[model samples]
Target: MSENNKIAKELVEAVGGKENIASVAHCATRLRIMVVDKDKIDQPKVESVDKVKGAFYNSGQYQVIFGTGTVNRIYEEVTKLGLESSTKDELKKEAGKSGNWFQRAIRTFGDVFVPIIPALVATGLFMGVRGLVMQEQILGLFGLSPADISDNFLLFTEILTDTAFIFLPALVAWSTFRVFGGNPIIGLVLGLMLVSPALPNAWAVAGGDVTPIMFMGFIPVVGYQGSVLPAFIAGIVGAKLEKWIRKRVPEALDLILTPFLTLLIMSTLALFVIGPIFHSLEEVILNVTVSVLSWPLGLSGLLIGALNQVIVVTGVHHVFNLLEIQLLERFGNNPYNAIITCSVAAQGGAALAVGLKTKSKKLKALALPSSFSAFLGITEPAIFGVNLRYMKPFIMGLIGGGAGGFLASIFGLKASGMAITVIPGTLLFLNGQILLYILVNLVAIAVAFVLTWMFGYSDKQLEQTNEA
Candidate 1:
């Protein structure tokens, strides 16, 4: 009977009901989907639904965007129909349990860290281009080796990059408020108040050292600046609060009253509790990760190595990203870089191994190019076409990745930046026998190829490789 529940049902129906969908998952701005058949999907119907903006297909899934929490509702609706919300490719996973440790880890990493990627990529490319462009631009006005060019560039880069996080409270408010069904502006306003640098640096305040909040608390809407969790929480809370206020206020002036009360209550709650709690949670996650990685480098490396292959197969490799990224943010560097570097190298090796082992000219060709891609930091081809479809190569890849990851971890090597691909990915770590790490990865590939060559091959591949 509630407006929210009614809207949720209507939204689900708009997406073509239970029969039309095969599975679903969600990311920051999109709902990754699988339909019984793509043609059966009623794209027009779904798009027509309120709050539904657009939909598209990518990487073999039909994705719908209804903001943030929208995915949860649709997911709930799909489960009500008893159909799972996962891809056939991800069929190895169970339904609700898809929220397992791996899934949670991956989702957290992919969601939190992905937002920074576009800006970081832009900044890196900017720095790269500036090196080439600075002198040219400087020639227009001043002289060579212009004053503060590099310094200003670095400062600009830091400001732009840090701004994304520094103003994160408002940013989070905007996204999350939209998700939770509140007027997004309210959350944004709340975020601005909290993150505005003018506030007396409230977040760092200690128990006895200073007051929780200074003059800002005296205002009607308390600021939450730089805080993400509370703004995120407020969006949901504000939406709910707005809904309740809606019923009590006369319809004649409902809109104004709803937002006013909603923003006031949500911001108040956010300042007092939500922000601090989430910040603490982030700390806890950070501490746990550091402790585990530091406990025994060798074992951690071994675990990443052995499991990384399986995680990749399940598209669960993202599961480890949170540990990696969060630690980098909190502690300034991560030990997992070595393992990841080796894993990538192992990908190239696996593809090469599969190519060498296969007799099917088609598979060999696929494997060869895929190996090149993996070496360059792409792994889908090897994963789907060679390793997964053919079991032996996949197993060999696991053995290789596990061994390489373990070795790399023990080496205590680290990477300063995120490696997007394999080519330069090879450049990720240069400390501590980096060459030896390279050798280890190549050796894994060779062993995989030799093992698969000796024991496994389809007759087609056997004839093809033999004839070649």
Candidate 2:
């Protein structure tokens, strides 16, 4: 058999053979398996399987980390063994059945926001580039100042940097509707209506440059340009309304009448009710978040950075998606991204130290790649495969993260983006904050590495692991 085939067979045996697997699927980095009985699997043996970086039980599924590209190959091999193949969406539904109401709600929010991140990341990169090229110092070298640049060129840059955020509500609404099982096209239309050109621009109204149109002589109505909660709630309500109308309408008129009624009712409710109420609620949430992050003496950064990896272990870290989105929407910069990068970078550092110090070749092999993965902002392999397996290293990483976060807050470092972090996150800092970003991440890594090297790893621990 080929190497992936061999690993696939070993993995199947490790998880209690083919009979115990109810279904199998793969995401970007994991081979997710829904099992007949969680108790039947040998956790250690699964981790020991060659080419498997780590394994964890999460959301009622056994997720084996194989990194990108590798998981697809192994997944194909696993399916060849007669196990039922499944989609990631199907696995999500099965896993959703096990979580509590809060977990389910958070997962739903994650589902709604995750698909919209790539557009934001691209926009952030464009913003960073625009900032770089428009710098007074850089423009001076080229015999140009801000006024020397062409208006058309400036307009083009604005288009690149501003379009995604200007239409953010539409993206959120579209994703939310898709997640809630409505017609995505209808969702797109409804979302477009939220930011229609006919309405006064939200940013302009906020700046007192324009007045909002009054719906009933008292209720002010403006476009939702960078809004999140309002659009998200509208999507949920609109999707449900569409589904309900579809069931009641006659089969002959279902296509035309259902959409017409759904859009009409949802549009009125969204503008007069959901939009106004949720927008206020979103502002309150933004205020609370800002207050927490602005705590005296960098306490907020220290706590969040130290605890972020711990939260990741609980499988609920997706909740940060909303906070980061809100921060980017309201402030146009995200300090939370800078703080979390420290926590993530520290994981890699601890894993690197363990990899270098470990006497066991098996562990050294696992730790090195896992550490590299952590530096690139995906920490699961480092956290589960290396650092957490050696408990002291994980704690050392937390300390390192806290130290870096404290400094980040003191420096007032922030990113122009969200979703991406650690090394690749440099793009978000290119707008004049790159130096501080580098310094903070280096501090985090150095502290974790030095601490872990001194006290966290030894051959004795390997012996204990083998014995267990």
Worst lDDT window (10 residues) for model 2?
459-468
TM-score of each: 0.61, 0.97
Candidate 2 C-alpha lDDT tens digits along 1-468: 899899999999999999999999999999999998899999989988887888988887899999999999999999999999989999988888886888788778878888998998888778778878888988999998989999999999889878988888889889988999899888888988999999999999999999999988988899999988889999999999999999999999998998899889988888888998998898898899999999989898899889989998987888888788788877888999999999999999999999898878888888999999999999999998988887999999999999889888888888888878899999888878889999999999999999999988777888888922
Cα-based RMSD of candidate 2: 1.5
Give the TM-score comparing model 1 with the true structure, all chains together: 0.61
lDDT of each: 0.58, 0.90
Q: For residues 1-468, could you state the per-residue lDDT of candidate 1 as single tens digits? A: 544456546645665666766666666445666655567665556544444434554344666654446656655655555656664326323232344565544543344335545543343334333433455454456665555466866677667435544665676666655544567787678777666565545444522454445325543223343444555566667667877788799998987777777777766677666666666676687778777666575787777766666766565565454455455444444567556655665666766866765565655665787677677666655665456555666776767676777766676655544545335643343323346656656655666556556654455644443433
| Among all candidates shown, the one with the greatest TM-score | 2
Error of 2 at 125 (Å): 0.9
Which stretches in model 2 have alpha-carbon errors above 4 Å?
A: none
- The numbered model that scores best in lDDT is 2
Q: For model 1, what is the alpha-carbon lDDT of residue 439?
A: 64
